[model samples]
Target: MLETYCNASGQRVNNEKSSIFFSKGCPQVTRDGIKNTLQVHDEQLSDRYLGMPTDVGQAKNGTFKYLKDRVWEKIK
Candidate 1:
């Protein structure tokens, strides 16, 4: 699947430096299988991913505050 995506997208994936994200509902067995197949480590959830929230909780405003600030700055 990853290989197909890379082929289609023409983007190379560096497995050593990559991390895969899985939904909370994903089963452990499925996670393990995917990890093994991809030879990539599981993503460790953090406050932000590529400057966006990894997990947006009840506080949507707070979660996206940075984006709002960025837009406001751009407008100014």
Candidate 2:
């Protein structure tokens, strides 16, 4: 369900950025799938992105902005 979609989206994003390897599998879920799950959960998937943790000592503003931008871009 929602956890699966978030995990898959995270994996897909990591793979795309080479933060994680892709040989495992593509983790991109369909837009319809995300939409349906979000509806059931009564929350948007982007909310999960907002709550994602950044690496310690990383530039919070820059990194989060980048991740958010990328996630939204992919969603589009």
Top of the candidates by TM-score: 1
Give a tens-digit lDDT track for model 1, residues 1-76: 8789989999999987778888899999999998998888756666666778888979999878889999999999
Instruction: List candidate 2 segments past 4 Å from native.
Output: 1-58
Question: Candidate 2: lDDT over CA atoms?
Answer: 0.47
Q: In angstroms, how far off is 53's CA in candidate 1?
A: 1.5
lDDT of 2 by residue, 1-76 (tens): 6468878777432322222112224444544465454444232223233367534235677657867898899999
Candidate whose lDDT is highest = 1
After TM-score superposition, what is the CA distance of residue 64 in candidate 1 from its true location, in Å? 1.8
Q: Would you list the clashing residue pairs of candidate 2?
A: none
Q: Which ten residues in a row have the lowest lDDT in candidate 2?
A: 15-24
RMSD in order of candidates: 2.6, 15.4
